[model samples]
Target: MGSQSSSFSLRIWRAARDMVVAWGRIGYLGAVVGVLLLSPSTYRGHALRPILRRMYRDTAPILLGFTLLAALICLVITRIVVVTALSYGLSRYALEMVIRVLVLELIPLTAALFVAMRCTIPNATELALMRQSGEWAAREQRGEALIRAEVLPRVVAGLYASVTLAALSCVVALVTAYLGVYGFTWAGLPGYTRMFGQVFNPSVTLLFVLKTWLFGLAVAIIPVSTGLYARPTHHDIRPGGELSGLARMFAVLLLIELTSLMGNYY
Candidate 1:
């Protein structure tokens, strides 16, 4: 019993340590964003335009497909919730509540879940396969851009996909909220913007941005690292190793959402 508890504690500690390192890397990305932008001598558009363009080039179809699917799912869910609330004679506040719960909570969670389903496992699996096949070792020994090719691009691309999709999804949810509550009316604009302002205060926005970035990082890093941690014989990898990484990824994402929610409301 004591050994089991000790082992569990160690796993928890390792997961925490990995999250710390990931956040540290994200902070470094933020710092580099300035250098990346300053060289163009033009702030008319984001200096990160080309990066985003590259991201769109690589993942636009997948991103759009994800967005459409999420919109459809959330639309149904929101309709059910709103219709049920109306049946309870709470229609007046249904819009507010939906925006809060669906827009602020479910949509983001859905986005993360979608990314996990789409990217995390495959990235982790591929990295594990590569590690098993000695690709990492070959690149390392050959003095090649292992970090650039294997790590950074995946990291950047995943972040771009997550962030873009989350932002777009939130916008979609907001618009859906308006149409759900006050169908086809411009007068709803004021109320919509006001409630949006309430929900999307600067602090909330910061948390949203930070959370999306974390989601992106989690979706990218945990699996790759876990893949790297696998035994030399890829097919011989202990099932538990991949499961452990996925468990940590979900845990970190939940912790982040909890912390951000508390930050905004508490």
Candidate 2:
């Protein structure tokens, strides 16, 4: 029994140590990418092309479909909120609730997850495979800054995708909410604008923007970092690397969401 207890404690210690190490690596990679992103030299000539191509690849293909999906979701949820508020004699607060819930929260989170599934996860898996096959090391040995050439572009693309989708979806949600609440008319524009302004006061607007950027950063950084640092395994790389990256990204996203909630509400 004592031996078993000691073994279990050892396992727990190793797990905790590994978690800390993983997060440390992620932080270090993020800082490096952030510096690269800010450095003008990294954007010169050849590098700029890849970043632009990645941004277009990540954003263009799915924009219309994502916006339409967001609008449909916003419409359904707006109707539900409007109906519920009417039933409860709280119609005045319905628009604010819709804006708070859909625009500020749901749309951004949904956009991040969508981009992760569509682009980043697959990118990460490819990077992990490259890492495992020694391609990254070979490039490094050849005096190439693989982080700038390879990682930075993907990170930029992820950030662009998340922010673009969220911004567009928020617009769609607002329009849907207005139409749902006030029908197809212009009479409610002034009142709707007033409430929109109230819910998105300066502080809340800052928080919302910050939250969305953090979401983008998580969507950008976690998977790529995971892939860049993943260890080789005998089994297929996809399941392990992609699953771990997704889990880490989700955790960071959840933390950002919770912090935003606290800032906005408390």
Report RMSD for candidate 2.
1.4
lDDT of 1 by residue, 148-226 (tens): 4454445465666677778889888777767766788899898778877877788878887787777777665665556
Candidate 2 per-residue lDDT, tens place, 1-266, comes to 99999999999999889788878988998999888878998778887998899899989999999999999999999999989999999998888999999998899999999998888877888888888888888988999988888888899999999999999999899999999988999999999998888899999999999998999999888888888888888777773256656778889999999999999999
Alpha-carbon deviation at 103 in model 1, angstroms: 2.0
Q: Which residue segments of model 2 deviate by more than 4 Å?
A: 239-242
The residue pairs that clash in candidate 1, if any, are none
The candidate scoring highest on TM-score is: 2
What is the Å distance of residue 73 in model 2 from its true position? 0.1
The TM-score that candidate 1 achieves is 0.75
